[model samples]
Target chain A: DQQVKQNSPSLSVQEGRISILNCDYTNSMFDYFLWYKKYPAEGPTFLISISSIKDKNEDGRFTVFLNKSAKHLSLHIVPSQPGDSAVYFCAASPSTLYNTDKLIFGTGTRLQVFP
Target chain B: DVKVTQSSRYLVKRTGEKVFLECVQDMDHENMFWYRQDPGLGLRLIYFSYDVKMKEKGDIPEGYSVSREKKERFSLILESASTNQTSMYLCASVRPDATGNYGYTFGSGTRLTVV
Candidate 1:
């Protein structure tokens, strides 16, 4: 069973515009969500994260919004740059005893920012 | 800065061969993880270790084993390699009991191909 899902396989945005990536989770136990950015031949790097207690968290150009009722979360990047083009993965952890902060990741969405 | 290093960036093996993927983290984090990433499937956890000599099986632990001989090193073992095992393998580390996320740091990944 896939606890987390990223429905969109790819996304494209123009430079200086906004890019939004979406994620959903079927597991209600999950309370922490994170987004990671990956470039070719490199491991994923942390971008931003949000706790379930808060509806939104912002970090400079990146922001994450969570909707617990809908089991949905999104990462928004404003003023997108060409360097931001890469695969973005959304991951979640339940923080429960059994889960132990183990991350369940989505399939990832490839973002292409056009210059 | 945390550095997670994988033994090999690429490896090729024949079917029925034994293979080992090694990972080391400099941060002395308590938790270490192994994952396989494939197209359309995202990242799937293979194994994780919470402490020295302690290990846990993850969602896709079948046909695999792990070793945590020391605090800084974790190894993934494939007793009998198969073509299906061809995929990109990643190792990550985090603090086991920390709530604020000592944040997961991932290795550059090892691409394995079994003929």
Candidate 2:
């Protein structure tokens, strides 16, 4: 079963515009959500994260909003630059167990920011 | 800065061959994970180790085994390779936060082809 899902396989946005990537999760037990950006042939780098306790978290140009009732979350990048073009993955973890740090990840959304 | 390193960037092996993928983390993280990423499938966890000599099977652990003899190294072993195992394999390590939230530091990834 896919607990986390990224419905859109690809997204395109013009530079200087806003780019929004969405993610949905079927597991309510997940309390922490993170977004990672990956470039071709490189490892995924951490972008931003939000805890379930908070509805939103902002980190400079990136903002993540979580709606627990809807089991959905979104990452928004303002003034999207060409450098922002990459595959973005949404991952979640349930903090119920102290020793468990496994993350469930979405299929990923390929974002293309054009000039 | 945390660095996770994978031994190989690419490898080609024949079916039924035993393959070993090595991962090492500079940070003394207690949590280490192995995942396989494929088209439209995202990243599926193969195994994880929380501490030295301790391990747990993740979502897709079949046909794969892992060893964490030392806290800084985690290795994934394919008992017998298959064509279906051809994909990008990722290694990650996490240092847990006070709230049990983890931000993963990932390796560049190893692309394995089973011929």
Candidate 3:
């Protein structure tokens, strides 16, 4: 069973515009969500995250919004740049502060920022 | 900065050959994970260990085994290679107690091909 799902396999947005990537999860036990950006042939890098208790978390140009009632989350990147073209993965964990750090990742969404 | 290193960046093996993929973490993390990435399947966990010699199977564990003799290193063993197993393998590590401050760090990944 796929607990986490990224419905869109790819997304395209113009540079300097807002890019929104969506993810949904089926597991209610998951309370912590994270976003990772990965370039070709490189390891994934952490971008931003939001806890279930909070509706949104922002870090510089990246923002993550969580809706517990919908079991969905979205990552919003403002002023998207060409450098943002990469595969973005959404991961969820049951609990992070108490040692349960096993992440369940989504299928990933390939974002292409056009000039 | 935390660093996770994989033994090989690429490997090719025959159908029946045995294969081993090694991973080492430099941050003294207590949690390590092995995952396989395919074209559309995303990242599927094979195994994870929270402590030395203690392992738990993830979503997909068939044809694979793991050994964690030391806290810093984890190895994934393929009992018998198969063409179906050809994919990109990723190793990740994180502190078990890590929360918002610490997230999982992944290696560059190893692309394995079975002929």
Best by lDDT: 2
Q: What lDDT does the true structure give each of the candidates?
A: 0.92, 0.93, 0.92
The residue pairs that clash in candidate 2, if any, are none
lDDT of 3: 0.92
Sort every candidate by DockQ, greatest first. 3, 2, 1
B36-88: candidate 1 lDDT, tens digit per residue:
99989999999998889999999999889999999999999999999999999
lDDT of 2 at B23: 100
Per-residue CA lDDT of candidate 2, range A28-110, in tens?
99988999998888888889988889999999999999999999999999989999999999999887234366889999999
Native contacts, share recovered per candidate: 0.47, 0.53, 0.58
| Candidate 1 global lDDT | 0.92
lDDT of 3 by residue, A1-115 (tens): 8999999999999999999999999999998899999898777888998888899999999999999999999999999999999999999988857555678899999999999
Predicted structure with the largest TM-score when compared to the true one: 3
Docking quality (DockQ) of candidate 3: 0.63
- Which pairs of residues collide in model 1? none
Chain A: TM-score in each model: 0.95, 0.96, 0.97
Candidate 2 vs. true structure, TM-score:
0.96
Residues B17-76 of candidate 2 have per-residue lDDT tens digits of 999999999989899999999979998999998889999999999999999999999999
lDDT string for model 3 (B17-55, tens) is 999999999999888999998866788999999999999
